[model samples]
Target: MSLGGETAKATIAKFAMAAVGFFGSILFARELGPKAFGGYYLLFSVTKLADRPLMGWATASKKQFADNETKRRELVGAQFLFNAVWILIATAIGLLLADRFRSYSGIAMAPFLFVVLLVSESNYEAFDRVLTASGRVGLSTWTDALRSYLTLPLQVFFVFVLTGYAADGMVYGLVGATVFTFPVIFYYIGTRPAVPSVDTFFSLAQYARYSIPTDFFATLYNRLDVILLGMLLLPAAAANYEIAAQLTAPATFVATLAGSGLMPRVSRLRAEGKTVGQEVTNTIAFSSIFAVPIFFGALAIPRALVVTVYGPEYTLGVSLLAGIADTVYFRRRQRH
Candidate 1:
């Protein structure tokens, strides 16, 4: 547990993931353009919300079985069962709401596509919590980040070369990428420690109860503005808002990586009778030092980047990017 080793690995994963996400965003934005990009963003947001039940079960299972192998396995099984129920329930709601709001701005998916997409996405992602609880954030972060990067070439080719379908191509690329990596992920899961059992599920009731609001609040914090923009502004304006906000996603990813890496070390230090106040201070000081400059720089160059990088049509809301950049700063500050 050399601090230097942990620090190096975490830094590499953080910057590498952001770099990949950055280039991928450019490719994706170009492929999607404004209109189709907006639709893709909206659909992804909705599907993300639909994933909370799976997330809740995962979080509960991970926490409950953090130290127990048999319990962990049972918890995983229950997580799948519970997630299935929610997927079914959400499918029914999607059928009704989609028919009623076929022309809606933010959510224009087919009757059951929302549930189907989220279920597929979440089922794989849910294991992430388990990995994290097992102190495998190192593995989780690097694996997922690498997976995202691996998906980008195909996404670029499929969206631009084979099909000019924009958002559809983007979604297909995602599903296609996940499909390709399924075996690798499952193999990794198998190699990791397992705690297979049924009773672990029943012991997790309390943790599941607490996970609901945490998941909802976290989702809303990240996405409430998108929902609000769709309702309050014109569709075009809302699309602009989404692009602006999404540009800060890399910043969010960086902060998450930093915080995740630091927290466990800080916790261990505190347990070993060291005061965490200095660590907290150092974390904030260093984060702000690196983060502030990048944010301001991005704010200054939003329009040029949006136009030359994404497309000319995306220049509709330069101010919004700067605004969202500040949002990321404040968000990091508050969390830190």
Candidate 2:
């Protein structure tokens, strides 16, 4: 497929993921109720934060795979090694601070759950980025789509059938979905593991220098509010905030697709010694057309939307939805 076709496929997949996630959020809220859903949201947010280091390596690996196809296997194996080691360190830290994490997050299982969910999510991300960067975007998209679409049903089974533990059930569903989708990533990574060398470490270090801090602050910027809300307020408040944040996902998903879809194209333009300013301009202008409607719609429709989708109790989050709606632009700007 051509670039436009690939991008359209990714964009469609992202939107489908968003739609599935939005419905899942509603089901979670309805089934778990506010307090339990809030705890689950906290679990989700913290795991998201825990993904930073893995995200950094994944971002670097994506660039390496896109830029150096011959080295892709080595790059993939080295990254796999790095993440395995990092997970061990994180596991030790979680064990040592298990009690503290329980006290802080108010979830007795926070430390254990965090480690399990983080490892699963981190591995999924590492593989996803490599596939995307390697131009197997359709495969990558389907992997993500499977995970996204499966979460709701899996959570229903776990939460309602197997366990009454709402938050834990959700975490279980997430981990399972990720694991179920791994074979696709594994197949694309191919048959052999590339042995890591001093050169592999050096390359990873060079890219990490640029990607780590970028990922760190980006994760914090996106997740800090929910973390703080969890700490400072009742679980209901955090759940409300989660609802608001999720409602803007259509906007967020579109913004992400715009960025990810255009990165290689932009990089290619740069490599060909072609001026990219016009390309950037065209990207921003095209994105703004869709972005404007989503942003303003979120701002204006939050109350009705919350009531319609999540019921009236969630209506309290209307302001929060409108406030963070502009984050779509922030997501877009970072791609530049």
Q: Pick the candidate with the highest TM-score.
A: 2
lDDT per residue, candidate 2, 1-336, as tens digits? 244456567778887888888878888898887778888777777777777788888888877777776787788788889899888987887789888667655677888888988899889887787777755665678678988888778888898898666788888898888888887788876735688678877988898888888998988887888888878877788888889878776665544654664665666667678876765565565464465677889877778888788887787787787777777755655554
> What root-mean-square deviation over C-alphas does model 1 reach?
3.5
Steric clashes per prediction: 5, 0
Encode model 1's per-residue lDDT on 195-277: one tens digit a residue.
Answer: 43444555676677778678877887788777666556544566677767656665665456545445445655655787777
Error of 1 at 184 (Å): 3.3
Which candidate's lDDT is highest?
A: 2
Worst 10 residues of 1 by lDDT: 101-110
Candidate 2: stretches off by over 4 Å: 272-279, 326-336
Assess every candidate by TM-score.
0.83, 0.91
